[model samples]
Target: MNATLVAVVLSLFSAVAYAAAAVAQERLASRTSDSGVVRLLGSGAWWWSVTLNGSAALLHVAALKYGPLTLVQPLGALTLVAAVPLGARVAGRRVSAVEWRGTALTLAGLAALLVTASGPAPDDVLSVPEALAVAGITAAVIGALSRPGTRPGLRHATASGLASGVASALTQTVTVAATDRSGPLLSAQVIGVALLVAAFAAGGLLLAQTAYRGGLGAPLAVVTLANPVAAAIIGLALLGEGLRGGAAGLLLALAGATVAARGVVTLSRPVPEPAQLPTKEPEEHPIAAELSEEEHPVAAVLALNPQSASYEPVLIPRQPAPAHLTPL
Candidate 1:
């Protein structure tokens, strides 16, 4: 297979893996009472989710090795596409029309962005000091986001998505550096990048689980939107990548991104009320009414004899036969 084709396949597989992991994490979140890290660590479902995520990261790295960030990163949006149906299946709910529309819009926007993206540039290796600085800044941001009072909603999920994006960008950088080098993989640069990858990946997983607690749409959307943008920014700034059509291409990409973001927001909106079913008035049964009246006749008897302590036989005196009967 062509290297580009291989990368595309791997990227798609990675997206599916990510989608499965998101579904698993959401399931685990819904069932667990304790949201603590320790509790999550102990959960089997959580472990399964972790395993899926690990596979996804590995596949993504493989894809990055052969493909440009512009191609591979935008394709990752398919995770959101895959997740909607999977999540709906797991929850036993049908995907609403609005959700379907949102999904279409999101897909369309991503397609537009992908088409307008620039081709890959030559890889640039980061120096040890630059790598360390990046790692430090990423760690600090993640730490601040993980602090208490962040609340478990859009804010928290967005933070998590941002962390995940940083992880992805770093992963690409590290993969390129490690693969391009002819020497041993344990070089200082490679090792530093590896450690940052581990730290960021782990942090992203935890935050993603946290985000799942706030439902799949918003956090997933935020992550979906942030990840590629972050990768593209890093690629453009650090690497020598450039858009195809210069200013026009950049504007088109931006517009597409905006549309995609709007779709995500729409997808994340609260579910609309289900279609109302017509209600039928209960049919009255005459026999049932009679049975009810027979079952509670004490009230009627009490009304007739209010003075009586309880229901008993009441006798009336009978008069003697009429007088004036002739003797036989």
Candidate 2:
């Protein structure tokens, strides 16, 4: 079989594995409130998700070995394509039309972005200093985004993407070294880079899992888009892979990014009001419940009966002031 054909087959299966992993992560996230690493590691389901992710990563690496970057990278967008429907099925919900639209937009935009961004497979590896710089920068970015904030899931997804991208870059260095028999395997440099790669990869997985706590579609899309873009940025900066098609390519890339961003925004939008079930009425406060309608009609009305109203104020009987309580 042609290597390209093998790569195609591997990429497709890799996408499926990745999609399944996302679904598993999302389901676990929905069931658990805590996204703590310790809590996640303890769960059988979470570990299963991690297994699926590892399988996907292995398949992806195999696919790359068999094919070119341009072919393999675009195929990766299929993870989002697979994830939307897969996540909906797992959650026992129908895929909303809005989700479909968002998915389409995201895929189309990502395709454009990948087409322009991907060039020849980069052979260059990061120097020790460069690797350290990349690791430090990626860590800082992930830390900043993972902090408590609005759109926590999206923030975490972006962090996940950045971490994954850096890991990919670092992995390239280690893989290249391993492939070249001329160099001694297990050198200190290789060991150090490999460790960095492992750290970032683990961090990425944790962040991706946390991203799913908000819901599935938007966070997944964000991760999908951000990952390649981050890697491409590194490639352009360090590996001599320039954006294709010159100025036109740059314009197209920007447009694609905008469209993808719009799609993510669409996916993140709250469900239509009509589809949401009415929320339960708030429980009465204990003090409010203790007030009687007659004795404290106003308080009772305000707390227990929104429709009722009274102007009368409760009158306390005048009692002789205690010596200490008297006005100075």
Candidate 3:
């Protein structure tokens, strides 16, 4: 088979594997409230998800070896495309119309973003200072996002993407260094950067697993879009890479990002609950009812701020009883 054909096939398989892994992770997240690494390691489904993820990573690496970054990276966006429907099926439901539209928009935007962002690999490895700077910034961002009162699934997903993207950048540096003919294998710089890559990659995985707790489609799409965008920024800033097509490409990239962001927002929004049945009117003072199970928005907000002590039940002022009312 031609090298390009092999790469295309491998990329497709990689995307599928990633989608399947995402589905498994989402189910596992839903099944358990605990986010501890030790608890997740004990779950069979989590292990299965890990296996699928590892397989996808191997396939992605193989695809890169045989194909251009522009082609392979754009194809990686297919994971979101594949994941939406697959997740729906696993949940025993059809894909919602909004989900379909969001998935389509996300896929389209990411394809454009990846195509424009990809360029030749950097010639030089990241220096220790540069690597440390990148790591520090990523860690800080993640810490802020993980703090109480942030959005639950979405913030975690964004953090996951940041970590994964940084890891990709660091991995690129290590790969380039190791492959250089003049450079000795296992050089100090390469070793240091490789350790950073491992740390970031593992952190990304845990964050991704956490992100799946809410739902599948939106979180996955965010991660998919954020990963490449973050990596491309690092490439542009630190690695001497340039966007394709100059000014026009930058405009297109921005447009694509807007579209993708809109899509993610749509996906993240919970489906509206059906109208509630009218209840009998209460006499005099009535205690405000607690949030119902169907109040998804309130529940989501509470989930984001689990430890907040400020919430209080609303109380209605007492009113005089009607003169015509009969005593029960």
Which residue pairs in candidate 1 collide? none
- Please give me the total number of clashing residue pairs in predicted model 1: 0
Better of 2 and 3 by lDDT: 2
Task: Indicate the TM-score of model 3.
Answer: 0.72
Model 3 misplaced stretches (Cα beyond 4 Å)? 1-12, 62-76, 148-151, 267-328
**lDDT values, one for every candidate:** 0.75, 0.76, 0.75
Task: Return the top candidate by TM-score.
Answer: 1
Worst 10 residues of 1 by lDDT: 294-303
Instruction: Look at candidate 1 and tell me the lDDT of residue 260.
Output: 77
Off by over 4 Å in 2: 1-9, 64-75, 148-152, 270-328
- Residue 56, model 2: lDDT of 91
Please provide, for model 3 over 147-219, each residue's C-alpha lDDT reduced to its tens digit, 9 standing for 90 to 100.
7666568899989988877887787777777878897998998899989988988888899998888887678
Model 2 residue-pair collision total: 0
lDDT score at residue 191, model 2, on the 0-100 scale: 93
lDDT by residue for model 1 (103-143), tens? 88888887777677635433776567766776677667666
Query: Please, what are the lDDT tens digits per residue for candidate 2 over residues 27-129?
Result: 8999988888889879999999989999998887776555445456556667877876786687677878897888788677777876675555445667888
